[model samples]
Target: MSRIKKLLMVVVALLLLAVGGLYLYKDAAVRSGVIASGDQVLGADSTTLDSASLDLFGGGLALRGLKLKNPEGYQQPHFFQLGGIDVDVSLGSLLARRIVVPSIALDGVELLVESVIDLDGPRLNLLTIRDQLRSSRVKNAEENSASSGQRFVIESLTVSDLKVMGLMTIPGGGSWPIDLDVPTFEIRDIGKKQKGVLLAEVVGIILVAMIDKAIDMIESDGSDKLKIAGDIRRGLKFFNRGLKESGLDPKLGKKLLDDAIQKGLGDLLKKKKKDR
Candidate 1:
């Protein structure tokens, strides 16, 4: 019996050692992935991976002060630097094949839009940074689908605080500054197939907004009116199609959107009509 007990102890010790080694290995890998991912997303090299820790046993992970260098000529470097990003992801939630992002928080995100036209365009491109995030999520989803464990999914995304600065060129001279604060943004069920369809609708809305903003920028009374109407029509078409596919009342949705657009642009259109 003593011999058997000793043998069992040896086996248990070996098992414990194996488990400990695996935990450490996985912890390191997770940290490396986080650092690499942060670098890739910013299109910049990682300047720091100050602290990265993982607790696989308890399904907790943390990454802190992951910094990235700004791309050359990008305002982020000159004006404001991305201080760092903090992320905490759940391991069990990740393996459960559900939208499982516990939290992603970014701090000190900076952008400098130069008054110069060439720099301004690239600065404006920064607005599309969400696209890169979406791509990363998609890649994660694909990996999760492949794994037997539940994939990390994102059901809702919360933006705690966001600041945007837009530098616009005036027709004859100086720059006009537009500052925006996005206090909260929630995106739902983004990890599912329906995400594509939902994203299409969102992109459509953004396109409409861009067109309207462009028309406003033109600053010609008649031009604004014409362009606003065109944008309204385009947005309605997209809304109509989405509603139809969703098996909702397409006509009602289209009519409602049209009414809202018309009401909003009423004065502009009426003045144009009178001038004509």
Candidate 2:
């Protein structure tokens, strides 16, 4: 009986060591994957993580300090910096072939736009990144069998302390300075089982939500703002359908908005000429 008890003790110690090693390896993989995904999605080489720790036993993950630099040829030092992501994971779902993160809180989101003279001329900052991801994702989806596809789900997400700043030149002329503060934002049903969500789809959501708020800061006439909003809604409906095939891509919603703004400016210029 004593020998048997000693054997059991040894087994338990070995098991603990194994679990400890596995957890440490997982932490490293998480950091590496975070940087790799960011680089691929943004088309930039500069991506790094400050820290990532996951308490699997506690069913939670904490990630902090991520920097996403601009794509090649852009002069901006970095596009966005993410402070952290705190997630409450559904631990049991990991073994079931689906990653189900129930709640996620993101903090310290920032976007910086800088004036850079690209030889290729001007380009949309964030929208360009979305276009790259959409093109590749659609191509891969076509290549793969739908039945074998994987899923990533976030039941609910909350983002706080978002700050966007800097200026970009419009089509007609002149540059517009942007300074925005998004204190609290929430999204539910991301990557739902019944109706899955894609990157472009989420981008559309971000675009619409951000624009809806930012438009108010433009200091335009009330009637003018309303007219712009009407144009934007119609444009989003059109572009979203095109990009997503059946539904709206909301990610490409910004494209439609840019076009609308350009047309409105052109029309204004024409009216001015007539008045002259």
Best by TM-score: 2
Model 2 per-residue lDDT tens digits across residues 174-259: 34566768558787877574344333334334434543443343323222433443443332333223334323344543443345
Candidate 2's TM-score:
0.64
Q: What RMSD value applies to candidate 1? A: 12.9
Candidate 1 C-alpha lDDT tens digits along 100-138: 555555454443433222312212333233344456445
**Least accurate 10 contiguous residues by lDDT in model 2:** 234-243
Every model's TM-score? 0.48, 0.64
lDDT of predicted model 2 = 0.57
Q: For candidate 1, give the lDDT.
A: 0.43
Regions more than 4 Å wrong, model 2: 1-14, 44-46, 115-117, 140-150, 194-276
